[model samples]
Target: MDSSSVCHAEHVPSCHAEQKRSIHTGWRADVWTASSLFLAKISLRPRIEVALSTLACMRVPVAFLLVLALPICKSFYCYISETLSTACMPVVVFVAPLCNAAALASLEALAKQPDISLGVISHFPQEQLPLHIRLRLAAHWQTASALNTAELLYAAEKMHTYFGKIDVLLSTNEHVQEALALIREKFGIAGMRPDVAHNFRDKARMKQRFFEHQIPCARFQRLTSRQAAYDFVEQVGFPIILKPLCGAGSVSTFFVDSYAQLEPALAQLNPSEWNVALAEEFISGAEHSLETVMHHGRAVWQSVSRYLPNALDVMQNAWIQWRIIVPNAAEQVAYSDIRHAGQAALSCLGLETGISHLEWFRRPDARFAISEVGARPPGAQILTLHSRAFDCNLYEEWIRLMVYDQFSVPTQRYACGVAFLRAQGYGVIKHITGLDEVMRECSALITDVQPPKLHATPTGTYEGDGFIIVRHEETAKVEQALEYIINTVRVTLG
Candidate 1:
């Protein structure tokens, strides 16, 4: 791919054909590589004058001049913004994991907005990201971790003079939503108010809000003391699930099959880690997630997906594996009940605009009960599948919602699914078996694949060590291929 195509592939803005001609593909490298370097060391008057003269002498289009001379323009823009205070661009504070190449590419769609200055607040440093992604970020501030909101806020404050005012706070990962909301309030910025943040962050409070709206969900109790948990179990019976009042990724979540099971789980939990604990009556049913994109208090796009064996079970039992299926035809029709519940949950949350990852269950009687909702995009390559299935860049559209308050592309053209491969036994990964069989059998149906590395230790997430995404026009075909993959692929550790 050419430089312009590479830009679009990274979700960056592309130069027009006329602009491309000015650079003249073969001639660009040697000239601009030298020009951009010399462009940086020069000063204001001489910089623009020489840049214009060089471009005019070469008959380069002005837009191509901006592309080749991006560094010059950037330094110039910063000079004006910092010195003359003449910059009118809105400054947006973005927080998300920066390690993944795909995530970085998607995020670049926002960071490279020409008229806007993006202040990236991340747990990972620029060194952690690829050079292509690192170069795109206008300003970067690293934190000790995602929880270090104070560090992020202070950095933003220090950058205000240089970048004007931080207008909006945004995060693609749900873990940072509450922090983003708090930061927005602290800085007098706009978007996703702190008051509205609770409906997603605090799962116990979220269930209460949903229940208040007459939305069907499992019975839950917010508990502080051990006695309260026991009392909840007495009333609601055994087989309860205990989790942090505010948590993500089913981390530290416990499943209690009986009083015997409850005691050991209770003894292991340290209440100090989480401010509050949640004990809820566990419901037996199939699990599904309602993916919705909201704009101005209304859902403009929605999709339904089912999980294999459920996340909680997958976490509890090391042997259990899982996959997510974005349903086709009849499954989508059957998921209409969940779609209704998810819409109601968002309406009750009262969030003006954002993405919702709402996990709900369908009981044996066909009753739909909400599990939890996160005010962010679903993880585990769900967005990747959504993009392939819909023939749109879901990540780019998601960033648009965070930056522009709307989803530019709005249609689904296919169905998609992902099967996560994990080690059945725990230890350092020693070998992977049945890979060639699965890949060769499923190659045509698979869009992406990453086999587990030979010696890396396993990450104890639902995603496991590696995963393969399969997509097709028919959801049934996708489902069939996923089942085939999960059954055949094996990661063995010793």
Candidate 2:
């Protein structure tokens, strides 16, 4: 067996024995032993006293027999108490910086679940967490650096001294998924393993897996040298995409249209043996994202959304405000092809239980090509859009699926969309225009609004300064409202 293969308690006895063997010994082990002893002393004191009193009142032969039976009874008590302790409330550790908006949202959902024993591993101190979440936590371990694997493992170990075995260790941060997977392997937590996580984090490896499975995706190459980049372009021609082997969002991603554009992008990338980069033949067409929930290695539910002009275009043109639309009928018969392909791609990539955000393109020929997948929830208020569309709390839905292996399929009741508000030029915002007109025109359709602030620096991403979420039973109505907001409401910076 591979040393890194995950071993679960519910598996064969040998698997449980393997986990037992992997536990650290010496001082840390002593602390765990002491904790268990303390718990036992507090819980079994009354039972021990009752047993001693009964034994004292008995005759000599009966007393000897009772004494002989006492050891067996004590062992039974320990077994029952241990089982109850483990089965009562599941221990879940969420690892991420507390300052992230997405993390805070997820933390709130997890804390609201009364049956979970939640612990947190973060770079920020425990006090930074909201009072409600802090009160619900079983323990919180702050590391000097959350991304450092050594520090993360130490935090989990220290948490184990009080919580025993961690049922699940997770982080929504893409940068921390691989590190958390390694920690899960080290502790035998049943979740995504390192190899599966690597397939999600490394775009090069993910594209290779897609190829092996005959999954329809863009042509890609792992570039290790400048010559390799040149050779790939020679074979595939111009208009290629370049990005780090592992990255998130549109940061550091470059679109090269010609030879003149390639050198500057390469200089910024500095691709070499150690600093590997990925290049792909850019597929020009409509782009969309598919959100899927997997349970025991298969997708159970899915939702799809369309980008107004795609992420690259929004990044390239700073003046363009980004918008996303989640059609009410995303799971209908029309999207059957992409739905099947997306699920198959996830299975091939070995994602077990969690929500995944997958980006894909619809080519000019009307064929869908998978771009990349993240082994976490979709960011940029996409899930919030889903919740509005379904009229259910998707945040709690994610928590239930990840923590309890349960999913309640939500009914899609409305078509939802979000229009981002981005300023036209550089510098802090000085003036805003056309807001009163939008509210007057689409007040009935507008469900939530976050107007941009004055004198605040632009966020510089596709998700700009603020956003407005709108939903309606009719998809066209939602689409029309989004268009009106993007065109009418404008942010001006001087």
Candidate 3:
């Protein structure tokens, strides 16, 4: 045997002896580990006392043992408490300013949830938010000079500086879903990816996917020039829908029915206003929109609403009173194809966990054709109407969807409808002619009503001035109440 292999204590070197002693000491932590570890928790005082009591119960020698472990328990306690303090609180960033009713309501709803905080990164200032709503914003909000991608990223970095780092990004604004998606990808955060958002934000691309999937969607053409518009007219004929490729609502949308009306509608398209415009063969049908909350690339809940006069008609005629009703009934046999096509459309878009506001057509033959899908919450007070109709806090649901990646709320309970008050002509609001009459006739059925404000600016965006919401178990009653509210109320602009 060599000297290195010797096991005799007398023959062992000083360094080897100390190594052997350390091994013995490490192995001897038997009782200390069992009692001290069990009791040495974040609750130091009580844990130490209980651990000491446990050792006493075990009948171990304990006088110096408790004293030795007191400091160790203090260190472990600090570690655990520190971790618990910072680990649970998540940081959220909102893309849009909390100035509008929708943004404000969503913020308030998010505040009520546990273990989350929000920091705003937007083009608007904090003062833009109403005082009450501004008070709820987390840490603080940092405004970017522009809503462009570069400035947005810088503002987000500023937000990160203030709130630690972004854990969730709430993409609530229209026409900027692509920007939000890019930011999410660059930062390697949890949110809508760029590819998925492209399919939503880009209309031509979206329609192309729908067509390829054998999903029933109206044929569309991207308008590059006057020649392209004319070519589309000659090829697809008149009665086509002309709208901004990436716009929401009906801001600059035009419905060209006759051959003579095509150029005037094309004249509405300004290269400065929009980079691209699309003209599609308009499907003649009853226009309705479906609101879906998706999770893990699957739709978890869906709500269908019928658009009064359709959005195209609403845009064409300013006097049209727009109302969307969410019927209480689920699984309508007529809408089966619509639902199936909507699902296929969304799957192609790769909506993993977000809300989709899809508008489709039910033709005279009852066939379905998707008009468009917006990868955002439904605007025009539809969310609030859904809340009243279904008896679920949809604003709360928005927060839960964006922050928690969850859609556990019930989306349908009662049939709900909203009649929007829009200006018949361009001017400031002078007066709202009917309220008492609406209440007298539909008081029991009315859930919410905000009369138009005086001197308010009006642009044709579907949601103009104010709206009245009503709900009931009966869908026909809800429709009747909407008809009453629209016919009864008149917004005067001078």
Candidate 4:
């Protein structure tokens, strides 16, 4: 086929236009040679052939390299795209693993197209893969899997064998350092490097940093022994927060209101394993979080969210409910100062070029102080909600920033907010009410409403029982709708 025909056949409109332009400019011969080399492999693979062809038409060198490498090395690309696609829609996935697998399987089926080649592979053990391929795969997997797991070690060794230019590694979990080292040796990306992730994961160390930085935070001390904890209370007084240093999702987080409650609280923990706990002066106020994208020592995009009734209190109650508010324009001025302070704190901590979730408290006087900063996306599907409200794909933005050092600036077209619905009392969930009505009534302003399914009881208050994320061109409408939903909807349990 002629180059134009080939471009059209490959569904690369841009390529055809460019080819026509080049021909008119007397560069037809050179253009044809390049196009031929690019399309040489289009006939080789059917499943990803289209993706490959699209990449070829765009003349993306990395795509070409990956295409060439695919045949020589057994590699699988897992697309979590479906997760984002179906997230905002009204759908209940009772089984998370099943949903993930089905999504991957459907993507695999789609890969059967003439333009696509690679297929989705299940998360199988290393032993199932070819011995040669197993080595590199092991290294990448070690970052996600437990080090003690056999698969992790296998992956680490495999990673070391392939890409060896890495130098530094960062992990919050102490159990994964050895795997990090192995992967560093294998791929040479960099040896394990000390980072704030370690300190953030270790509650005691995190508090120490805050103290050293003179960052406003609760008065706190860490203890490993029961006697020490008791002594700490004697010195600092009662009613403190206690939790594991490296745990997520508020797991095992408890509040000791008095010395009388300390022992029972301690009983719930394994001092030998849980080891460390923080005794801190509890600050009473509204809790809010600043989500930021920092680059080159500056915060580029920042979002401020106020937790309804507060997350700490919600976690402490463990049986009550909570929601979150993304302030409208009128409240922006008040929160902007907090966002600036958060950005400054992140800058001081040497956090640059990544997404950060910083929790803060706004005291009665309107003063703000940092609670903690995590070097990852905020939990509770917040990213999805933000994307829905702003018409921006944060994950995609993050990927671009990480890979290409570029991000899209969001057009502030509408104000968006999410309010989480939580169980009123502990028991099996009888039902979730008001989602249909909320969607129908606020259809003009509400972008998405995802309520917990019937029988989907929550195990903890912080489990994100359900959420309603909305976007409105006018800030007043957004606020009114949010108030209406909060006042009307109820998550009842038997």
Which candidate number has the best lDDT? Answer: 2
Q: How much lDDT does each candidate structure score?
A: 0.73, 0.83, 0.73, 0.55
User: lDDT tens digits, residues 334-445, model 2?
Assistant: 6788989999999989988889999999899899999999999888889889889999988889899888889999988999999999988768888889888998999898
Who is ahead in TM-score, 3 or 4?
3
Off by over 4 Å in 3: 1-87, 142-146, 270-274, 330-333, 409-411, 424-427
Pairs of residues clashing in candidate 2: none
Question: Against the true structure, what is each candidate's TM-score?
Answer: 0.81, 0.81, 0.79, 0.65
Q: What is the lDDT of residue 47 in candidate 3?
A: 70
Q: Model 4 Cα displacement at 210 (Å)?
A: 2.5
Error in Å for residue 18 of model 3: 64
Report the Cα lDDT for residue 222, model 2: 95
Q: Give the TM-score of candidate 4.
A: 0.65
- Indicate the residue-level lDDT of 467 in model 2: 89
Q: Give one digit per residue, the lDDT tens place, for model 3 in 220-274.
A: 9887776777888888887887888887776788788897888787787843334
Across residues 1-494, which tens digit of lDDT does each residue of candidate 1 receive? 23221121123222343222111111222333355568577776976688789879999888886687789779768754553432465667677644553456556677456555565666554456565555455555545565666655655565554355787677766666777788788778877877789778888888899888999988998877777788998898888999888888788899997888887777666443345688888989998888898888888888888888888988887766678988764557777777777888898987778887888888998888889888877777887777777777777787777776667755677788998988867679998888899889888888888789988998767788899998887988998999888888889988
95 in model 3: Cα distance from truth in Å? 1.4
Worst 10 residues of 1 by lDDT: 19-28
**Quick one: how many clashes does candidate 1 have?**
0
Model 3 — TM-score against the truth? 0.79
Residue 100, candidate 1: Cα error in Å is 4.8
